[model samples]
Target: MSQPLSVPESHPRPALIVVMGVSGSGKSTVGAALAKAISRPFIDGDDLHPKSNVEKMSRGQPLTDEDRFPWLAIIRSTAERVCAEQAHSGEVKEGDRPAAVVVCSSLKKIYRDILRGQHAASTKMPAEEDTSEKHPSGAHLPASPALQTYFVFLDGTENLLMDRMSARKGHFMKASMLKSQLATLERPGEGEDGVARIDIDATPEEVEGAVRKAVKDMVGM
Candidate 1:
């Protein structure tokens, strides 16, 4: 059975947590685990990508911003919906509480800005209105609160990343893409709010604990 999207708990405010990095950065695994641990919904940003996008990556073609724009829209809209719904329910009095964790590449600061802009626009609109249709798929998503976004940057040595990618099967992303991703990644700097970096060598449990603490600290949960 598919998991329900919005978390059931009474959140203080809606948060838009982005667990992001290159392909082998364990975004999906860590995102899902963290969500389960926190009792919040996890949205795999990769699954939101169109098949054509995956195909391009499988062919080792790096995606240009034009190609990635629509995919980012889908992810932003999904997170917006969760935040809007929770905020509208009146459970979260503050407008900045994060409602869910969205796993995405979020490679560049520009991409992060775009995601933030989308949510900011959504939150500014009236709750009864649906602005999500303006996005890529033109799908209607609920209005979200002022998003408290967090960035979890997963990093490791190039050799380690390649090994992880090489071992994986059935995925569209190839080990060959690792070098490109590593070269392209723009690591978040200290000034960025809610940013945390974890060495990929850490155990899954350890990573989860760090993420939980980060989320709790951000939301005061």
Candidate 2:
């Protein structure tokens, strides 16, 4: 196993890490563990969902893009706030780089763009174009102190995901919706920045360790 990465003494910028995957991919479990290991705050994206969206998912219905826009907005705002707070805290030590981990599906490329402060119109650009260079959407984005975002994608076989979901209880998201969630997922491409893909077949501890190592490599921690 690889050793955990520590923030360099000279690096003070706080990073925003998004743990993403379809339901039952251990996003929440691994995300929380990663945050604790890195000494950062953790936010569960499911808690930011609107009640209507929750109800729809509880009924085993997939949420439309419209249903997700508002929830995604909330997550963006919350993450930006966390980043701002870290930035203003003043003279953070290298090992104490005030990072935050958000457990979000971020299954779509467009959603990740929004979190990264890109305009929605950029989504219409050709796949080869650098959408990150596009103008800001000026919608649902914080004013300043942009957070450098990283993504940790947890992937596994559908059968394993289904079995995990079946064993989970008391969640609004139903196991039946896993198929739709998987279909909606868009794996991060090479052009996308700061993305780490990890296989979920390993134990939760191993998964978190891999995620930490990936983040360290991405950010030069």
TM-scores, all candidates, are 0.73, 0.75
- In the range 1-221, model 2's lDDT, one tens digit per residue, is 12212334454665778999888899888988887777677898877665667779889787877777656665665666665455455434544556679999899998887667565443232334222222223223332334577889999999999888778777655665788788888989999988899999988778878887987788654
- Highest TM-score scorer: 2
Give lDDT tens digits, candidate 1, residues 146-207: 45567777778888777788878877676666777777788888767777787887787887
Name the Cα RMSD for model 2: 9.3
lDDT of 2: 0.70
Candidate 2 segments whose C-alpha is farther than 4 A from its true place: 1-11, 50-62, 94-96, 120-145, 169-175
TM-score of 2: 0.75
- The all-Cα superposition gives candidate 1 an RMSD in Å to the true structure of 6.8
